[model samples]
Target: MSRFELLVRGGTLVVPYVGTIRADLAVAGGRVAAIGLDIPVSDAATVLDATGKLVFPGAVDAHFHLGIYRPLSVDAAEETRSSLVGGATTVLSYFRTGQHYLNKTGPYETIFPEVLSSVAGHAWTDYGFHLAPMDTAQVREVPSLVEQSGVSSFKYYMFYKGFNLSADSRDAKAFTMSDEYDLGHLYQLMEAVAEAGRSADRRVSLSLHCEQAELMRLFIDRVRADGDPQTLKAYSDARPPLTERVAIGEATTLARATGCAVNLLHLSSGEALAAAREARAAMPGVDMRFEVTLHHLCLSYDELDGLGAKVNPPIRSHADTEALWDGILDGTIGWVASDHACCLEAEKGDELWPALPGFGGTALLYPILLSEGMHKRGLSPTRVAELVSANPARAYGLDGRKGNLLVGYDADLTIVDPDLEQEVTTDLLLSGQDHCPFEGRKVRGWPVATVLRGRIAYQNGQVVGSPTGQFVAR
Candidate 1:
């Protein structure tokens, strides 16, 4: 019998917060057992020759929407398969009792179990849920969810406060399906989260989608009254940076009052980044971390005219995109994520107003960061790994097991060819979504093989085996 189950030989390992090191890694029983030079190839049952590649820790895609637009089982099957293409081994998806997901309001005890059952056998990546407490009843379930169910993170959509986006629906309540989803609800939710954090060993935090809805209503009315050009620019105008700025103020103020740890999700504009900095200065007592998505750092309204590019805190100008890059480099941003939601083309039709916001990008998570951030912008491989892998894992409670190429961690990683180049295409992504907003952009650095739990799950652009993904408890 072989000493090691699998061996990956001669690759540069991107260790988060640590410099890249040239080494060979051995895996036994789905865990990294050793990392050194020149272990005998005959000692391993299976060996992958990775002489010229870079080995990165499989990304923990922190923000994802599984089954948001499709059936849960179908999404769990296809979307997580797509995740393997990008070297993502785990997905922490957000679930709430809302209009799009399951389309009902109920207890997390019943609803969360159902969500789990639906995704159980269908998944291709290890997964967990950040369940949102939309109503007061659910708010009381926070401690139980954190302690028993191993769900420590929650989300609040500040944009759903008073502003309604639907053409047919009259009120925001129709979308949220909750009782009073205002600052009052958020306040109570924060207090509950803070108390839960104090009692639990894991970190309990609230992630806010920081775009002020009342200001959105005002700007939306103004945009409609004027020419109201049907473009991405118009969409950006309708939901400007001021909304995000104000929302940050409100959210942080409440976080300070409640002593709740908060994460500001998808800061889209330069002004929004500035506002987050200001909040950090003012509320020094409150714990706050900032997240920037792939699209916010790369895509811009000024360049991408497609309506499918429309997203919450709508894509800002190219200047704003550069500003976000500055935040990433200067250390203001805690982590980068895909915020990957697989919205199909039919869902994001020609109309900008009624169009769905997100598109699939999990397949491009590591690729784009390596191409645009490392190759183009001179971000170190270690820093790139930190943004996509280690930092998010530490923040979202998947820290020790999933983040880096550390001994005793899960043997989840990808072997990347540093010079591999390809144009972006929906087919290349292997997602259920039929269209890609980043369709034509050329990218360098692609994963030649992705290994999940000591097994090659994806190689040469195809999923290699059956679904062996287990649900992550935390």
Candidate 2:
């Protein structure tokens, strides 16, 4: 038999398509070399006894925002480490040009290098980027970004037209995407993206942040006018389920008109899923895909009050959460992500009415979901792998390469003690943000050892390897 670099001894390798069984997974040159029982370890360079562990393919987080929430140089590396601990071996973060990233100027030509520089050698696992087109210049640069930056995925923020380019200090209400002229320009950019995608055999998928801007502005006005702080449901009542439904319909219509593939981000309500279903059924060429966050699956609008759960489109009702769970089991929901945007406690506590749109939950995702999703909810372990790893990889074109435990796949794997129990604690987390909404929440199943490219990057509670995470060129 051929010699191997490392051998994972005596674990039941759980490949989704292939049934689970006892096997020894061998690795060399960062790819799976062999799998069978009782491989003699005398010839191997290193060995891991995964005797009682559920060895799973490392997760591929399809949606992540590296530099947007904070600086890439300072925050991206740290955040990537948090992802590593949670078993995400590969992360696809979205970046846009302008002030929020670094207060920079010029097109992507000027902005791309600075973004790359900030994240150099700072991740424990591999990484990729998705660029959001904010202007005509970026729309034109899509093909080059795909070829050079290896970014095949792009984003379209429906509600942040003018606000996207402006700094946070500026009055966002004054420069919203609802400005009629800018909305038209945004559609033009979308059309350009559609055309660009045609040439690249792999259709460049556009991720849409679907929220109707005008309706949101109107609802916020009515809510503040009513001025009831205790009505935690007010946030959801304001950005009602209909709002997401409307935007989803608009996104699919645009996709059909332009011949582009659309992927809706962080959909929280039942109405939104219904719209996506309608689009797929109606539009012949429109490849419409949508996803819901793990937080949405596990939490609801009533559990933590409005602000704590005040994510965009909101946490929604119990009915909506149940619908999301159903979608996960049925496979209509493409993937499950963290949608983790960590805002400081002080920052998140700015106002009672409308502080900001998000909160941090990166470290809490896996344990919370595994505990609640599998243990409490009775979802099969097979379903967990599909939602967390396999489906996300396939959706983003990183399938066999990153999501599955197959020969020729990257040696990115997670070792989880399936029966381990733990409570969510901010102190133990590796995130740059200090607090999480899920603190004190208990969950079963935890990843103890995370391997990235055959290197032990995160084990127990500490990062073991250098942040030499390569820029994965898709």
Candidate 3:
């Protein structure tokens, strides 16, 4: 008799490299113990019948911002609930300390403890944080953060040189500011991070928000001077594809200069992808990774006529959408993130030009991808797993434990009814924010259930666990 804690039978288990196979999975001590047919299941504590279902590795959303500028308690609790419904089991998010979150300038020792306490006993999924080194002290303390809190990843917003994008100041609603670059400050920050990454035994890594700050300023100012709906054209025109092209070129150059592995966040245009590809090809030794969102994959400028469609790196033309799909098809693009920074509709301005940039997509993540990328585009299911699961896990060093359904990996899994199709509506959303840009869009794939570490965390639209989501170190 096998000592099994749980047995999941009748579903085809999809492992990353081996392809999909119908197998009975037995779990013990929170790891897959055996996978075969008719493994005697009477000793198991529980059994799950996965008839007519696809069992794929649960998504690891690498670029999420929960509790960013908001109070930690409210943000962490609500976002974890939102993540469970969307079938994401592991969330890797960035916490900034300058002025955006916590409102204090301090070291990781001060900030991390506060962060840990706020999120403790409140999350329904496993969590990890990437600290943004806002000051010189935080930069030097990167290795110590890794040693103390097990947080092995760090981020820098090359675009937000000084101030950051926050909610409203007086009204407490719509606040968007850009990061500035003080030459001495940014260079030292990058240098310190590279040194710390080299020394840390757990392999600390770095990520960058690559848009050029000065260019963005110039472009935004140019749009204002021109004025009106025509300014909309100027907005996309000034910060055109070339802006991303130039910025990506510079980022790759900086990564090579710093001798650090770099992950580029939110590469929306084809030009950006090509630039990353070109940089990697030119310098074979440089470690670089890039990702784009589901919104960029499906929606175009025409679809975004209202302020709701507005976002940074504004949704491009139809041709750009096609090109992004091309990148997804060819494997140049790495992972897919919701970038699920949501804002209320009231916060969005009446005009197209001044509206707040982002809208909610946490609830629509899987459905949007399934509708546009998999069902409509004819992308392989295996490829969907790679984009949503495998690559993100590998990039963030969570691969061994999070992104696969193999023996010894976490039992985090998503069961989807690929044939169950429905139109997306904001009324069904569970995020703290109430609006979505993809409202009214229909998709064919829906998550039937989400399991985190051998426990049913979400089923049929509600959370099941005790909010025992563990905070992952590195």
Candidate 4:
């Protein structure tokens, strides 16, 4: 028997907050056992020769929707399989008691367990959930959710207050199926999370989807009334950056008031990023972190051709994309995520108004950052590692166990061929979704292998085995 179960030899390890270094990584019992020079290849049972590749921590894709459109078990199987291609070993997906997911409303005591049961055996990556407390009853569950269920994070959709954008209806109840999911409910949720944080040693935080509902109602009405263009630009106009700014103010004000740590999720526009920065400056004492998504950083309504690129807090102009990249380069943005919701083409049809928002980009996580961010924008490999991996792990309470390629951490890493370039296609991503929003674009820095818990989950552009992914406590 060998001392190490697996060894990745001759690679440059990109460690977040610490720069890159040449090292041989050894794994034992699913945790990183050693990282140093001259670990003989014969000592390991399995060895992967990574002579010239860059090895990075497997990304913790913080924003995901495992079952938003499809059934829980199915998304668990297919979406997570897609995650492997992206070099994400762990995924923290969002769940809510609403119309699309499970299509029913109930206390998480029952619903959460059922959700867990449905996805338990189907996933191909370690997973956790960031639940939305849609009603007061669910808000009451926050304490137990944090302590017992190991759910350190919660969510509140700022735009789901009084409107249902999905159905183009004013009644949010038509979609949320909850009781008055407005600012008041958000306050209670924050209060619960804040209070819960007092007891837990780890962070107990709330994530807000910051798009104001009333503003959306007004703009949507105006857009529809003024000869709706039926383009991505029209979608962007309907739900402009103004909504994000106002919602940031509303959410951050409450975050400051309740003393709750908050994450401003998927800030889509330059205006939105500016508002978040202003809020951070004003409330220096509050713990607020900002996030940008891959689509927001690269794709814009002007550049993207079809409705497949349509997403909530709609993809902005090229200026907004550059602004977000500025945020990333300047340290204003801590992390980037895919905001991956596996919506198929049939769901996203020809009509922009009724088409579902969001498409899968998880598989392009490393590829895009490496291609555009590093290769074009001069983003350092170390910062790229932090943006995709470490920062997200710290934000959502998976830091010590999952983020770095250090001794005693989970041996979750990806070996990348930094020079390998390939065009984006639905077939390449291995997702269940039939069409890809980012097709035809060329990307470099492809991951040759992705290891989850010291086991090779994906290698040589193929998934390695059956679903061995386990549920992460936090």
- TM-score to true structure, per model: 0.97, 0.92, 0.91, 0.98
Residue 170 lDDT in candidate 4: 35
The parts of candidate 1 lying over 4 Å away from their true place are 164-174
- The Cα error of candidate 2 at residue 374, in Å, is 2.3
TM-score of candidate 4 versus the correct structure, residues matched by position: 0.98
* Model 4 spans with C-alpha error above 4 angstroms: 164-177
Candidate 4 structure quality by residue, lDDT tens digits, 94-118:
9998678898888999999999999
Model 4 accuracy (lDDT, Cα): 0.91
Predicted structure with the largest lDDT when compared to the true one = 4
| Candidate 3, residue 117: lDDT | 91
3 or 4, which is superior by lDDT? 4
Error of 4 at 64 (Å): 0.3
Q: For residues 1-474, could you state the per-residue lDDT of candidate 3 as single tens digits?
A: 448877888887777766888888888877777888876668687887777877878888887777754677776777777777667888887787755557666677877888889888887778899888766666778767767778777887665543344532211222333333444555666666667778765455677766665676676666656653443345476567777877777777777787777788778777877887899899777778888877777777756655666666767777778888888888888888877665667766676554666655665556666667888998777778888888888877786788888889988888877778877776666677767777777788887788888888788877775787888876
Estimate, for each residue in 1-474, the C-alpha lDDT of model 2 and write its tens digit. Answer: 448887888777768666577888988898888887799998578888888988888888777778765778666677778887688888888777654666564688778887887898776668888887766767788788876777788887776643432443222322333233255655776677677677765547788888776676677667767864544477777777787888887778877777777789988888888877777888867777878887787777667663555577677788888888877767788888887666666655635553655666666556755787778788766677777788777767676588888889998888878888877787667887777777777788888888888877888988885786888877
Give Cα-based local distance difference scores for all models: 0.89, 0.74, 0.73, 0.91
lDDT, candidate 1, 1-474, per-residue tens:
999999999998889988899999999999999999998899999999999899999999899999998988888999999999988988889998878878877899999989999999988888999988988999999999998898989999897886444543322222453548899999999999999999877678999999888888888778877887778888889889999999999999999999899999999999999999999988788899999999998899878898888778788899999999999988899888888888888877787777878877889889999999999999998998899889888887888899899999999999999899989988888899888888999999999899988999999999997988888887
- Give per-residue lDDT, candidate 4, residue 250: 97
Q: List the residue pairs that clash in candidate 1.
A: none
Q: Rank the candidates by lDDT, best first.
A: 4, 1, 2, 3
